[model samples]
Target: MLLGGLLGGALDLLYAFGFAASRGVAPTRLLQTIASGLQGQAAYEGGTASAALGLFSHFAMSLAWAAGFALLASRVGWLRQRPAFAGPLYGIVVFLAMRCVVLPLSAYPHPVGFPPLSTSLDLLSHMFLFGLPIALLVARALRR
Candidate 1:
């Protein structure tokens, strides 16, 4: 779980940072945006403190996701059996949950919309970088 969380969190952050950079967004601002989920518009005012919180919140969420998958995979044999398929599917689920449910419930200030290009990239990153790593790691752990 620890490994999955660290790896997935790092990968996800990297992707987010890279994507933000391509759009002329600074990494700190990106982190602040994440912090906005919890702190709302105040996150932008809090600077590094809020950015740190965002980073911590991101990793904590990654760990939670990893732990959740690990727990489910432990009980469901097939999840451990087919990491590739299950991982991507789980990514989609995570994407939906975050975009649909989690964001709406949080202090996020922006309206949620599935704009095609960004949405596609986000989904792919979650699948290939986030969920895939957690699923693969969990499957490997179970084999031991």
Candidate 2:
């Protein structure tokens, strides 16, 4: 699970950085935005320390997600029956969990909204880059 978390989190963060870079947003700024999820708007005004907190927060989330999948896979026999399909499906579930549950419960106000296209792209990326890799890697480990 740790291995999956590291690989998947790194891949997801890289994609985030790349996407932000293309938009002329510095990577640290993006990380700070992530930190803002926890620290509120103060994260934006803060310096490298806030960005570092965001990086740590991101990996912690990844590990939690991976550990969740691992726990489910272990308890539910059906999940192990079709890892290929389950992994992608789980990705969507993860996306919803973040968008709906995590965000709303965060320091921010209730209900979440973002630009339509950006939300769509983020959901897709979470499914493919974050959730999929974690599920697939855990599935591989289970087989061993």
Instruction: Give the Cα lDDT of each candidate.
Output: 0.93, 0.83
Residue 33, model 2, lDDT: 85
Candidate 1 wrong stretches, greater than 4 Å: none
**lDDT of candidate 2 at residue 132, scale 0 to 100:** 75
lDDT of 1 by residue, 21-128 (tens): 999999999999999999999999998999999999999999999999999999999999999888888888888999999999999989999999999999999999
* Residue pairs in clash, model 2: none
Instruction: For residues 1-144, write the lDDT of model 2, one tens digit per residue.
Output: 898788878988998998899899999999888888899879888899999999999999989989999999888866666776776788789888888888777764334877788788777777788777877778877878
Q: How accurate is candidate 2 locally (lDDT)?
A: 0.83
lDDT: which candidate is best? 1
What is the TM-score of each predicted model, taking all chains together?
0.98, 0.90
- After superposition on all C-alphas, the RMSD of every candidate to the true structure, in Å, is 0.6, 1.9
Q: How many steric overlaps are in each model, in order?
A: 0, 0
Model 2, residue 12: C-alpha shift (Å): 1.2
